[model samples]
Target: MYLFLSDFHFGLGTPEAQARRRQDFFACLDHYADRLEALCINGDLFDFWFEWKRVILKDHFSILCKLKGIADRGAAIHYLAGNHDFALSRFLQDEIGAQIHRDEHVFETGGRRFYLQHGDGLAPADWGYRLLKRLFRSRFNQKLYSLLHPDFALEFAHLCSRTSRNHSSRRWDVDGWAYREAARAKIHQGFDYVIYSHTHEPLLEPLGRGVYVNTGDWLKHNSYAVWEDGVMTLKYWGMPWMERSQEEGYSKRQVGTG
Candidate 1:
């Protein structure tokens, strides 16, 4: 099974809430411990992250350790650096056994093709945001910003968290068209499925011969999509995996197999 999750936005909420989110997501990982083929954290796993050559945020040690633990378990883990996290140096690649992805990645499972991305740096209409992303991702800008002391860096990360993404999560309005069009653009890629995470809208749209899936944010929907066999099913987390059958009077969440 290929599991996809994103938009963790760690360190942006109350300490308890933040930790719980991380724990819940990782606990979800434990369920996949035996069967998981690939674990894809699409993006935004960290709301504010700037990794100096020698420094990783001290606060995230436990979080990173958890991920490392999963990686240590032997399932191939892939992380697509989101707009929030770009400077993925040796800290993750060398220290942890994760195959980090900055742009896109292609992999195969169950005789099906998968195209994966964070989906933040796409969307042509969002030119202004894209410009900012470029600036953040620029090598020169990264070096310049790295000059600040760790104290100031922590403070800056906190400020940005309070003023930016956390403030936006309260509003779950989604860009339905942008994702649809983006998915449509990839219909001819010979891929069976295209998956992304930035939009936070739990969706599955069948476009011609291919399928598009958005794993929705953890904040609002508490939902995620699961692909088993040749089928994809979306189910709310923290609930029974199966829902009651309408006709058979039995619990099940099995929607269908694609």
Candidate 2:
């Protein structure tokens, strides 16, 4: 079985809340470790992630270890860079055997073709943000930012992230229709499944002969997707074994190849 999740946005809430969320995430990972064929983290696993040479966030060590364990046991780990945590370097790839992607990735698994992305700059209305994204991702900016001390750099990044999140919370009122439309367009382009994470809304919609899935966010809903035995499911982990079938098109089947 392949598992997909996104928008953990770690370090967003109060200290106690952050700890609880981290524990919940670790539990989810542990539950699927043995059975997972691959684990795809769509995006925003962290509120801010920047890796300086020879510097690492001590708080992330435990989660990193768990990921390493899962990879060591033979599960492929794929991480797509999100707007919040896009500065991934070689640490994850070298230590935990993760495949890091900056944008969209396509691959075949379980006899199905999949299109995966972090789903940030998809809407034409987000042109301003897209232009800023380009500037932020440029080599000149990255080099200049890297020259700062880790403490200053991380603090500045965190402040910027907080401001961005505040600005974005108001716009989620759109119900993610724009993202859904983008996904539908991809379905017409011949992808059997188009999976994205960023809007933090768990959704599964049948489009033509394909499917469009949003794995949702870990901040509130704790939602995710699973693909197994040619079946795709959207599930919530707010409570153990909780299945969300309220949507018009959803199922509650247990996911596995067995």
Best candidate (score: lDDT):
2
TM-score for each prediction?
A: 0.86, 0.90
Which tens-of-lDDT digit does each residue in 1-258 have in candidate 2?
899999988867887888888888888888888789999999898888877788877767777888898899999999999988788889889989999998988999767789999888775566666776777788788889889998788889888787556544336424677777888888888888999887776778787878888887877778898887787878877553555432346432333311
Model 2: lDDT to the true structure: 0.80
Model 2 deviation from native, Cα RMSD in Å: 4.4
Distance from true position, residue 40, model 1, in Å? 0.4
Lowest lDDT 10-mer window, candidate 1?
243-252
* Candidate 1 lDDT, 1-258, residue by residue in tens: 767787777867789888788778877888878888777888878887878867789878888898888888787778888767766776777888889899987787888888888777465555556666676678897788789898887787677545444333322226556666777777676887888777776666677777777777676555566677777655556764431211222122233321
Model 1 vs. true fold: TM? 0.86
Highest TM-score, which number?
A: 2
Q: How far is candidate 1 from the true structure (C-alpha RMSD, Å)?
A: 5.1
